[model samples]
Target: MHRSTRDIRLAEALVETADTLVDGFEAVHYLPRVADHCVRLLAARAAGFMLIDEDGTVSLTASGTHREVALDLLRAQRGGGPCLDSYSSGRPVPPVSIGAARAAARWPEFTERALAHDIAGTFAVPLRRHERLLGALNVFVATLPPETASPDDAASDDGTELRLAQLIADCAALGLQNHTAYVQCRTLAGQLQQALSSRVRIEQAKGMLAERWNTPADHAFVALRQYARRHQLPLDRVAQAVIDRVADDAELRRGARGGDDGGRA
Candidate 1:
C-alpha cells in the first residue's frame, strides 16, 4: 500500500510536464521533451508518436532520430504497429521482446524491419480522451548484446524496465492529451475566425444590395433571407450572390433597390 520514493519523484515530474503542456506547450520543441523523458527515465532507446487524424487513421508524426534534429518522419507507409494497437485497446502494450508479444507474428513485417535496426522491443501507450481515442506514445529498446545473457534470459531482467515503461506511458498519455486539447482549441479558433470574416463580408454586401435596389436595410435583409431559404443556401452565400458577377435574378436584385414603408408607421 506504500509507494516508492522514486515513483513519487517520477509522478511529480510527470505532473510538472503535464502542467507545462496544458499551458500552451504545443511548440515544435515539446516533442523532444517527450523523447527525453522516455529515454532518460524509462530505458527507451527510441521514442515516437503517432497522431490520430480525423479520418481515424494513425500516422507517425514525431521521432527522436538523432541528437540534433530531434524529430523525423519514418520513411515507410506502415502504421498499425504497437501504437495503433494500444490506441485501439486503450491500454499499455509492452512487447519487451518480439517473443513476449510474438510481434513478428502479429505484425510480421514491422517486427522484422524494426529488429534490423536493433530495436527488438516496444511499448505503446494510448493517448485517450474521456471517450475518444487520440493517438499513441511509443518506446522502443535496442537489443542488448547476446553476450549480455545470450538473449534467452533477457526478459527476466526486463521486468522492471517494462513496469517503468508503462508508468512512463501513462505520463506520456496525459502530456499528449493536453497537447491535443491545445491543438483542438487552435482548430476551433480558426473556424471561428473564418465564420466571423464571412459574416462581415456578407453584411457589407447586404448594404450594397440595399443601396442598389433602393430598399430599406431591413427589406434588403428580408430579401436575402428569402433567397437563401428558397435556394437552400447559407446567408453569407446569398449576400455573396448579390455581390458576385454570377447571377442577377431580377426580383431579388430589385428587392435590394428600395423599401415600401408598409404604412404601419
Candidate 2:
C-alpha cells in the first residue's frame, strides 16, 4: 500500500476507535471490530484481545476472525504467550515470525497451535493506564516482509506496527474506563431512586395513620416500625401494605401499641 494511503487509513481507524467512548458502550461489540480493522489495515492475518478482570482471570474479549478466537482461547488456556507477557509486564511484545523454528520455540505450545492454524506471526501490546494494565491486544501476521523475514531482523516498519497496536489498545482502554464509570453511575442512580421510593411510601403510610387516628406523624412512624419489626417484614413492604389498605386500622392500632402482650397505650 502507498504510504499516503496507509497513513490516511490509520488515521481513520484511530478516529473510529475513539468514537466508542459513549455513555453506554458495549465492549464485546467494539473490541472485535477494532481487531478486524487491525487485520485489514495493519497487514495482520488476524487479531485478538484478552481482558483481565478484577478477579485476575483472563477473558478472551474479542477476535478478528473465528480462527483467532480459538487461538486466543488456547493462549489463555495455556497461560503463557505474548498476550499475557505484555499484559503482565505492561510492555509490548515484538512481532515473532511464527514460521521460523527458532521464533516458534519461545512459546512452544502457543507456536504449535499457531502452526496448526496457519498463523505465521504474532505481536502484542498492552492495554494500560500508567502502571495499571487492563489487557493486551494481539495481532497475527502470516509472514514478515522480505527485509524482516527473520525474527531477528529488525525492520524499520516494526516501530510503525507497534505504534498502531498501541493506538488501538489505548482506544480500547478508554472505552472500558468509560463503560465502567457508566455502569457505576447507573447503579448509584438506581439505588438512590429505590431509597427515595421507599421513603415516599413510608411517609405516605404515616400520613394515612395520622389522619385516621388523629395521632402525631411521629407516633404513626413508630407504629409502622413496630409492625415491621414484630412481623419480620421489610420496613418498606409494611409501609406499602399500610398505603394499599392491606393492613387495617385495627391492625395498625395494635402495631402502634408495639405488638407486646402488655401493649403501650
Pick by lDDT: which candidate is best?
A: 2
Residue by residue across 123-151, what tens digits does model 2's lDDT show?
89998766678989888777656774443
Off by over 4 Å in 2: 1-12, 15-26, 66-79, 99-104, 144-156, 257-265
- Pairs that clash in candidate 1: 213-256, 213-257, 213-258, 214-257, 214-258, 215-257, 215-258, 215-259
How many collisions between residues are there in candidate 1? 8
- Model 1 residue runs over 4 Å out of place are 1-16, 20-24, 63-80, 99-104, 144-169, 176-265
In terms of lDDT, model 1 sits at 0.61
Q: Which ten residues in a row have the lowest lDDT in candidate 2?
A: 147-156
Give the root-mean-square deviation of each candidate in angstroms: 8.5, 5.4
Give the whole-model CA lDDT for all candidates, comma-separated. Answer: 0.61, 0.74
